[model samples]
Target: MYIDLAATPDFKRSLFNAIVAPRPIGWISTVSASGRVNLAPFSHFNLVSTAPPVVMFACNAPDDRHEKDTIVNVRETGQFVTNLVTWDLREPMNTSSFNAPYGVDEFELAGLEKAASVKVRPPRVAASPASMECELLQIIDIDPVGPGDTFSNVVLGRVVALHMDDRFVDAGGRFDVVRTRPLTRLGGNQYASTGELVELGRPNPPR
Candidate 1:
């Protein structure tokens, strides 16, 4: 059956979401100007570059109540930490996604402790397998075609520091991806994890 986003669903669902397949979740943590910390998960996130080590996450339109706490705090402080969500921390990661009031601290809400970040004001998750401390580079707010500045906000950050769990590091000092078991979002209400490894050597350039 063919679905039309322009008319049928009334812009409720977009085929782009499911067709994109699995996406990385940026488990972001930010601190308010008043010292409150907000932790939330943004599935619309990924590392954009490796040279300067930049990461980005996109926050969609705000709810009727107010703007999301994560976006608000990041704007106020200009710093945020991206914590890796392992399979073990899935419950707390989901718990942090709850929509709470502005000053509420999601770290405590999820029963997690805050670890001090060396280069940023926001703290990292104490139990996370890895984390990236970042400084805000830019925030691009996509203008909505209609009304409101509520389309989407894209935030880019330059990684200033990194934290890794020693156990996940191999003998050669390389981080083990399969062992980390990073949690990822799938279509609908589905989720996935890195189970097996698939290695393929790139083909040589055509003559």
Candidate 2:
């Protein structure tokens, strides 16, 4: 059935969330200027550029609170790290998603080891297969739509450094996605892992 997002399709939980399909999870970690650490997971995140290396994630205000710890910490220090969540670390990553109080150490709470980043104050998850150190580039506030009436802020960060697990890297020095087995967020409480692969040859231009 054809439905218009602006008028036809209702802003229901199933419609909006499922429409986005499986989104990559970004396990973000940040540190306050005073050295408080915070970690949280976000599904509304993706790589926006490559040449300059940038990524963007959306952080919404907590359901019953003002804002999330990650957003507050990034705004305070302008730096954060995006840890790639794999299937193995799914449980601990979920633990870090709780609406904990400010200054709460999610790394410690989730029983995850923190590896100090080379250029950022926030530490990366040592168990994660990959992590990107970033500096806050921009923050855009999105107006409320409907249903929950929740607003979100998009944060764009410039990646300054990247760390990857040696096991996931090939001898040629390239990251192997299959070995990484990154976890993805599905609609509702569902989740998925990296599946099979298919490659197609580039079509030649018409003469």
Candidate 3:
């Protein structure tokens, strides 16, 4: 059956996210000017460009709370880190998703180890297989359209440094996907991991 998004689908839950399939999860960490730390995971995230190494994530305000610690810290300090969550660290990563107080340290709360980032105030997750330190490039507020009238702020950051576990790297200096086993968010309360790899080449070649 065909249903317009404006009409709203009568399913168990909104199938939009599920229909989009597995999405990369971004485990973001930030530190306030006063040294408070915060961490949260977002599935609405992806790498935008590679020339200068840029990534972005969408942060939707919960209820009427206009300011989350992550957004506030990034805005105040202009820096944050995106830590890659693997299947092994899934539990701790999930713990960081809780809505805690502004000054609450998620690392301590989640019982996870933190490693200082070389270029950012926010610490990276020591358990994560990889992490990227970035500086805020832009933050755009998306206006509500129709239906539930939902909106979110898209935060773009430029990567300045990256840390990766040696175990995930091959002798050729390539990242071994199987070793990384990055965790991804599926629809609803589901999650997935990278399965296989396939390569495709151009059908036509220039003479």
Report the lDDT tens digits of candidate 2 across residue range 71-151: 888899999999999998999999998777788899999999989899989999999989999999998888887556567
Q: Each model's TM-score, in the order given? A: 0.92, 0.92, 0.92
Candidate 1 local Cα displacement, residue 125, angstroms: 0.4
Candidate 3: lDDT over CA atoms?
0.88
Least lDDT summed over 10 consecutive residues: which range in candidate 1?
A: 5-14
The residue ranges of model 2 lying beyond 4 angstroms of the native Cα positions read 1-10, 145-147
The CA lDDT at 184 in model 2 is: 93
Top candidate (lDDT): 2
Clashing pairs in 3: none
Off by over 4 Å in 1: 1-14, 146-150
Candidate 1 vs. true structure, TM-score: 0.92
Clashing pairs in 2: none
* Residue 60 lDDT, candidate 3, scale 0-100: 71
Instruction: Report how far residue 116 has shifted in candidate 1, in Å.
Output: 0.5
Q: By lDDT, rank the candidates, best first.
A: 2, 3, 1
Per-residue alpha-carbon lDDT of model 3 for 7-86, expressed as tens digits?
76343344768987799999999999999989999988999999989999986777747767788898999999999999
Q: Report the CA-based lDDT of candidate 1 relative to the real structure.
A: 0.88
lDDT (10s digit) by residue, model 1, range 34-124:
9998899998999999999999999886675446788888899999999999888999999998887778889999999999999899999
